[model samples]
Target: MNLASISTKQYVEQRDKGYWIAGTRISLDSVVYSFLNGESPEGIVQNFPLLSLEQVYGVITFYLANQELVDAYLKEDEAEFRRLQEACREKNPLLYQKLKAAQAQKNSAA
Candidate 1:
């Protein structure tokens, strides 16, 4: 088989936004996070039914083989998420403030 086709057979694909398993919308970040949080490969498949056990195991193998690189990418992704969240909050300060107040009130009632 050709190299490109062979590579596509891998569990993961590098997408425009981030890495995802082939044939699914599930992100590598989601899988890695669950795995790191003590979820087994089987458990991951249970959590994301779109994925197969074989795919989950392959992703775990990939993560173990490239831990440092994947960790760095995850960190950058988190930073970008935080930046976007902050921007959204800034754009809707009143809405956020009201939400925060409601949450606080709910917490206090609890």
Candidate 2:
């Protein structure tokens, strides 16, 4: 019997929303971050029900094999997110302040 083999390239995709699991909306960052935080492939699959254990493992392998490149992409992505967040805050200071206060209140309650 013959089994099909899949390429790592087929597991991850670079889209406008950054690196994502090829056919799904789940981000590679989500899996990578969870793995880094000590979650097992099984655990990751649990967190992202859309992903299978095979997909999670494949993503992890891809991340390990291209760690440096992936890390750089993640850093750049984070910077872009921060930039957009700041722009939004600047454009809507009142809304931002309200959100910030709400967050603080929530945190304090915790």
Candidate 3:
């Protein structure tokens, strides 16, 4: 067996400004979050039909092998998301308020 092939096989790549499943645009964060939330590999595959069972398992293995680095990256990504959300809310207070009210109504109905 080519140790190089086994050692160099990468499940994720950083490009287009984010980490994605090597050749697909599906973000690693999506799989990680779903897995963290108790979703099975099959469930994750269903949620992201573009991904295969192998790809999901590969990404999960990658995450497990690099949990500390991946966790820090996740934290940074979440902070950026919150910052962008706040900026959007400030830019469109009316739309934000309308969405918030709609969400509340939906929740009450549920």
Candidate 4:
């Protein structure tokens, strides 16, 4: 198949929460984040064993080809994540505090 034909068959899907790779639970954001963090495609595949190198490369290509749009989407997703985290904390202040304390203790121990 030609390049155009192959690309037209999207490897990513848009969901209510965020973009995911078409056939897997892996998030497109995670792939892009790893790539932006200077991980090689091989490294990304290593980190996410479920993903093939081709899928990782496709995600990177999509991000590179649409950097502005993808960045905006990522920013919005992050904001939503922070909002949900705050809401969860508000809903369970004591639990959140305890979890934070435990995490801090673990970090100190490490």
Cα lDDT, all candidates = 0.92, 0.92, 0.94, 0.90
Model 2 TM-score, 2 decimals: 0.87
Cα lDDT, model 3, residue 33: 97
Error of 2 at 105 (Å): 0.8
Count the clashes in each prediction: 0, 0, 0, 0
Clashes of 2: 0
| Residue pairs that clash (backbone atoms under 3 angstroms), model 4 | none
Using lDDT, give the best candidate's number.
3
Candidate order, lDDT descending: 3, 1, 2, 4
Residue 92 lDDT in candidate 3: 100
Which window of 10 residues has the lowest lDDT sum in candidate 4?
1-10
Candidate 1 local lDDT, 1-110, one digit each (tens): 67666544588889996899877888999999999999999999999998999999999999999999899999999999999989989999999999999999999999
Model 1 CA lDDT for position 13:
88
Which predicted model would earn the best TM-score?
Answer: 3
Reference-based TM-score of each model: 0.84, 0.87, 0.89, 0.86
lDDT of 2 by residue, 30-100 (tens): 99999999999999988999998989988999999999999998899899999999999999999999999
| TM-score, cand. 3 | 0.89
Per-residue lDDT over 11-90 for candidate 4, one digit per residue giving the tens place of the 0 to 100 score: 78888767998889999989999999999999999999999888898888888888998999999988998999999999
| CA shift of 23, model 4, Å | 1.7
Clashing pairs in 2: none
The C-alpha RMSD in Å for every predicted model, in order, reads 3.8, 2.5, 1.9, 2.4
